[model samples]
Target chain A: MEVSGGAPKSKVKVGIPRALHFYRYFPFWKKLLEELGAEIVLSTPTSKKIVEEGVQMGFGELCIPMKVFYGHVLHLIENHPDLDYLFVPRYVAEDKDAYFCPKFLSLPDVIRILPNVPKMLNFEVNVKEFPISQSVIELGKQLGVGQSRALESYKTAKEYFKEYQDFLRKGVPVNHALRLVQRDLPFTVPKKKSKGDIKFLLLGHGYNVCDTYINLDFQKKLRDQGIEVITIENLPESLFKVPVIVNKRLRNYWRHEEEIMQAIRYYLTKGRDEIDGVIFLISFACGPDSLISELIMRDMKVVGIPFLDIIMDEHSGEAGLLTRIESFTEMIRRKKRKLEMDAKKKVKSKIKSEV
Target chain B: MVQVSDKTDGSKAEKEAFLGIDVGSVSCKFVLIDIDGNLLTHVFLRNRGSPIDSVKDGMAKLKEAVQENEELQSYTIKACGTTGSARYLTKAIVGGDLAKTEIIAHAVATQSMYPNVRTILEIGGQDSKIIILRDGIIIDFAMNSVCAAGTGSFLDHQASRLGIAIEEFGDYAVKSNNPLSIAGRCTVFAESDMIHKQNAGHSREDIIAGLCDSLVRNYLNNITKGKDLDEPVVFQGGVSYNQGIVEAFERHLGCKVEVPKYNVLMGALGMAILVRDHYIDNETETLFRGLDVSEQEFKTSTFNCGDCPNNCEIVQVKMPSDENKVIARWGSRCGKWEVF
Candidate 1:
């Protein structure tokens, strides 16, 4: 319905490419779009065909996630021809003093290269220049809503966005979190980890790491090995408040780098006992991640914690990934077992001496 | 007194053994170890690119080796372990109690022989790994990426290009007095550097020696970079046979690199030890399909499942003798058909 008069709402079909920022910021945008009389159309979950199409269509220099994101756009264009508009947002900066990757800055331009693409409902998100509220109201106006209603929609969506984050803060899976937050449902506490279950602090970007296809079902594979995977996204936001090692070369140069840098520092020091090992997953050829992963590896090594660095690319074979992960888990198990045996020997020797 | 592996009483002297099969990218090995953890018989055979056929050949050789020893003729395999690139496939073929990764196997074998080993450099066919250990615990490890720069296959390619037998490749390295310098970053660049040295009038022996040094340099710079390597560094794997690389590593690190007795077969050896300890501790019945598995017939094929857009190529193995009973099915993202 119209806010200015009794005109009927069009129920405009807006296509959302389920990638990149989809893992983090999709909730707010989805809520904002749906409440503004537009039906949301999400691209399918990532599959091998999508990845293969992306790898073939994408340029060699682009990272794996970018290729995957491009694949999602092509998928929406080709599969859902009924889509009236494609919602490809341009992410310049989420915070002050740090910017998104250049890939994010040019996402909309890159996707528009394909022929016969839908009209883009592009939302330029640069909080430094103007508030996110302004961008939301602008996007809502594109969907044919009044400014007052758009501001209310933005406020309501902001609350839903926080609900989404709260679910993630409780260690819910990204997909489940989105579904739950949409329905306004409660998230149950995850099952308690057993005594023998190994805890692995998995570190990576939300998009690449959480995407099962990109990381080769990384979290599921870890659970298969009787391991409990804890990502930086699963931890509370307060964990990033401390003064870490803070080396200038290893500081939060990128916007999301703060989470990774801070997570490693916490695990290596105060929260060392919270996990048994660290598995860092990185996209091959990612500029910021290349440096971040090296620092993570070095920090873990210095503390003598068992660590594994899995570099994922388009052709990341499942066999190699499984082998590395299995070996790391086995190593932690044997190391703990050996320490127990040595402790038992010391007690036995002390008892013999007392006798 | 060999720690967890030799929990069995060696003095009892029972005719029982554990079997281990390692199917590598270029070769396969089968070994039998007694309860005392001593190598009873070992058969290292080039699989000729087919792991299944190689396992059959290895079994025949193992049987022949056992026939020569009167005391080992009636030995029973209490446990069996499989490892290497085709570990899961080999485990499915021969029916193994467990399938462990190569890194863990190498570390276990090295630690058993030299319990104080702080660093281990293992270079096998198609793979090379640097493992850093502290007090019998592996703290960090790095495996060669999708590159073949400093692996056994890389050296094998060069050795053939220079008209030298793979076995004699190392002897030439030791004979050369003046080894030329070559880049060790990429296989293509390393090959080009070798050609350049050859055109520049370097001796074959010197170039071969230089290749060995380049491989060692690659390992130190790429694989073991930023990691601490303490004393008692253990070097093993198929590549350890190259005394040239051994000398190169020793010279670069300024410390002695000890090659274990079963350097070429450590993966199989550690697997056997792991299987043995696990069998004894758990008291579970051995999953080995018995000695007749060598004679069993199997059919292995891969087909893409058109169930969805993923089109995953699933590997299916069946026992031909048992009315095509599906023995193992894997290589699928979603494990609906997987038995292993």
Candidate 2:
């Protein structure tokens, strides 16, 4: 598949392991790599065999997602033996307060230690420390591309990435947004509808929430229960623009944690009436989540909003999770009924007194 | 029974009742409640790895009890709800109108009885949990399903190992004046520590008390590490009946731990209440298949679908009366085979 953009003399085969930030940033990397005249090869989706292999091959203490990442790397190596380079970016920081998890920052180094792994092409994308454009130019230099051609491709990729983010903000799930970007389809936001009887905001990282296999298709389960499911990504940009942490002590240093905390704060303060409950879905053994979830739990308690924290791992059973979600929705529905009854009682009392 | 007698007599009245069943890994519990949330009767049985048999036995006993009681005979089971680990399995078996998690079920039951309760400590056969509440609404909760160090089964194994009756294990611990400190981080370590204490000539009472203390400590450190444990704290589930653990929790938290009369059956009670409320709100006929399900023979089978790279292992439950029809299907990633 050749395009009109300045084509390389020979098409370079680029291997992209389908794990970790791939769920979130695959569009940007894919568009950029294809524009640079490269063929993208992705590892297969995670499965039982992949998880077992990952568990056997990886450190016992490493989180399940990280282990799954290793399995994908192995898959890519086994399947695409002739690939020129494996693009494993060193994602240091995305926002000022939102830093990548320690595992993410050290992912490239971790994969490099694996035996017989192919050569990796990496660029430092620490928005806090350096410019992304500079990283792109450096990456292009390593890929043997001209400066002007690389710069143009980077601009096009950035635009596509921005559109992808916009779609996420408009409530399009990550996987669907990636598909839209890959197919060059026009971006259309799902029309907003009246909120259902019960609404819950699911807070978690994009990978844990979007991966159906990893989370056991939690979204579908919630939808089946006739409850509206909303994610942090569904919130508008304005909700995230204002700083939620007024207390200096509670200010989070991690980039994603800050975003999550901000969205939670927005829901508790401004969106309280619109939301019935908040469910925090975190991967087991996630260091950042272990700390951040505690903070969110404390804050949720103070706000008096119902909250449920579900930890998902390879061993997470589907029945247990469903029961929890079902009960939570039922409890919310009961609370709503009581509130309506109280309101009606007050109205009846007022009418009686007037009469 | 006292709570049931307190309600006004409806001698000639045809009252509606809701049924709740909690089928966990180690036990099965059933509760019957009236519309006003008065517990009519409850039964708890050890599952012994056969939830279907336990549920069927519980149902048969409940049916017999209802038939024997004049007041209960007039009460119609309008709705049914199921909860716990085998919620889906039991829900299918009973044709339940609603299915919920044990967490919600316990929280609802506690909130109904003690509106001001801020904390709930539930320890079942295989799992333990700490649920934080505010204004009768569950605010935060955590369960230790991954570990066995703090669950009821661990205590049962230790009791059996010590040649003491599980029922009398708590009394022995309560008799101890000076409880020794035993390692409680892992079950195997704790078991070894108990043996060492015994070999060192420590009294059985002290060792048992120490075991209880260790389990409580492990629970606080792991499941409820950062949770807010405000009072009034209500402890329930099978472990709540163990006075030794209750004392250990009370001593550690420096607060009173209230154990409800139907502590072990709280999940079933909560589910019944949920179904009662659900029926009232929706005003639709319940999907209950009736107590006759106890006599039916159900079958389950699973196969891996090869249509895609996902290869999801789809589980199908065949209904008893209808042999050819699949009552429910799960474990499919794409929702293609999910008949329910």
Candidate 3:
């Protein structure tokens, strides 16, 4: 209300907490905001100090991820005092049938109760009844931007977002993909380097899997060991089509849950040989991920493909996690070795009969 | 046995034996196996809160045992492998050929004896694991998470509280006609229930028997939930020494559960088997430091790394024989101080 949202003089500063769906939608938000002439600020990546402060400030009832978001919010509020507004979007439903967790739908109001908070830029994202542009226009009106101009910026941002997704489908990591897209560099897919003979499909929420401090850089650790670590976002989104994943009898109404199940189920059936094992990371902080992981575990069990479910709460001991992962890879290696030997044996017998 | 450089004397044949050390939270084991898979010496020692001491002491006993044997003269440790909670630490101290997880080691040991083993229930000192195998390969495994109900430490505590030695627990539990229902969801709840049963005029045998039943139920319901427990089921680890718990597993699965002869030393045996099988065709010299490590002094020190806010505790171990140089460093979350 005190200034023009687009002007360079006293430019509006919008703070985005680095948690939750930040990994998924940050690039799109940054593109749209930059086009609309607003500056953006982000909380730093999660650290030990931030996590401890978050746990102290957060109540016992809130889940670990909620506590993490609280820490990021506090970081943004305390670190960036010149912030004009905090962008906490109310994400309800991504599709016609799927909705987000209640925390995402309700956390904006919850943060409002915190003392001495900056003004919040609350936007609704419900793709079921409206397109994302409709939601953007409503937010644009609040920011004192013309609807037509906001619509134009939205279209351009949409293209940028699609390109980013294209990079993801090509197996470029999210961080590198974001950099390539944000810098508006010449488009070229990075060549795929085959590391390990084995592939592991890592399934988890984007926030849990992408947060390095939360998971102790587990994916990279696996990659260093020559195991090609992949996530749902790394593959084509078309794998989650209604015909491929959803049936009337078996469907998950949660958008994130549906993605996780679809990715795992894809590996279990059509892409069974694409991966040697599956590692589902579950944050004990969130109940839904655990429930969905159990369902995925059963499918992996029936197929006899190796599957390991690791749980992380406020803090997890690395020793236990290391042991489980080590043994799991060992099991897969032995199984592969035995299969090759058996195949060789069969071929040799056939050759003997021909001779 | 005739492969030694000078084989004229059978006693001086330099019998090739693999050394396998398993250092868990509650106990440590040292095993020696000849090339034929015959166990020469198996030593199980209580950890007593320090696995370093257990390893040092266990090695001493193994050396004395080997020297005392009349047939295995001119003894030489060909290769060494480590498994269990402190496997990495043990490897650093013992100069092991490889460090493998207890799950893999246990699975290998069981399938070597019973090739068709489908399920393996291992209740050790601080952890309990259930491994599912098919066609002699490990498929699925789960460790007891978030509780110590099925572990040996809790059972030992309960036995001491009831004034009964853990080794004789089976004798008392077998006499119970009606076992009391002890809580098995957690150690805290189980301890309180044990006290209440003592006050409620329940016999000691009944309480002990009830505790074993409760532990098996908790393991199946929590850790191995919905896991298939097929035939040729082998039970190993320290808990297999207790007849009551073994019988409880047999009853719970409604199948015959076989406990191998070296049940307590299966992890060590498995590691020995693994290293031997892996190096069977290779000519590479072993990295084993030999049994002299037991006579040498091991110096360990822990200091908080003040580099960051995390203040990770970095532990470093120095071998006095190696000019008192640091051998291994651990306990840093960032892996900056990792030396092994």
Name the candidate that leads on DockQ: 1
DockQ of each candidate, alpha-carbon based: 0.70, 0.46, 0.66
lDDT, candidate 2, equals: 0.83
Q: What is the lDDT of residue B6 in candidate 3?
A: 26
Q: How do the residues B1-340 of candidate 1 rate in per-residue lDDT, one tens digit apiece?
A: 0111233344443466898888888888887888778988888988775677788778777777766777776567778999998898889888788999998888888888999999999998888998888878877788887776789988999999999998899999999999988888888999999999999899999999998998898888878878888889999888999999999999999999999888989989889998988888987767777656668888889999888788889989889987888888887787776853
Please write out the lDDT profile of model 1 over residues A294-317, one tens digit for every residue: 777778877777778888998888
**Which model scores highest in TM-score?**
1
Model 1 TM-score? 0.94
TM-score, chain A, per candidate? Answer: 0.92, 0.91, 0.92
List the TM values for chain B, per candidate. 0.93, 0.93, 0.93
The digit string of per-residue lDDT tens for model 3 on A1-355 reads: 4456666465689999888888889888888887776888888888777788788888987777778888899988889999988988889998788889888899899888877789998688899878888888887876778899899989988898887787788887776665565566755777878768898988888788888778877887687667888888998877778433444687667888888877777777788888899998888767678777777777877887788988887768777888888888988988999999999999999999999
Give the distance in Å from residue B311's predicted Cα in candidate 2 to where it truly belongs. 2.9
Question: What local distance difference test score does each model get?
Answer: 0.83, 0.83, 0.83
Docking verdict class for candidate 1:
medium
| Stretches of model 1 off by over 4 angstroms after superposition | A1-9, A181-196, A242-245, A248-251, A348-355, B1-14
lDDT of 2 by residue, B1-340 (tens): 1112113264644578889999987889989999999999887888754666888888878877776787886677778999988887788777888888888889989988998999999998898888887677665677775687868888889899999999999999999999999999999999999999999999999999999999999999988886779999999988998999999999999999999988999999999998999889887776776666768776778899988867888878787577556777778778889765
Could you tell me how far off, in angstroms, the CA of residue B49 lies in candidate 1 after the best superposition?
4.0
Error (Å) of candidate 3 at residue A318 is: 0.7
lDDT winner between 1 and 3, please give it: 1
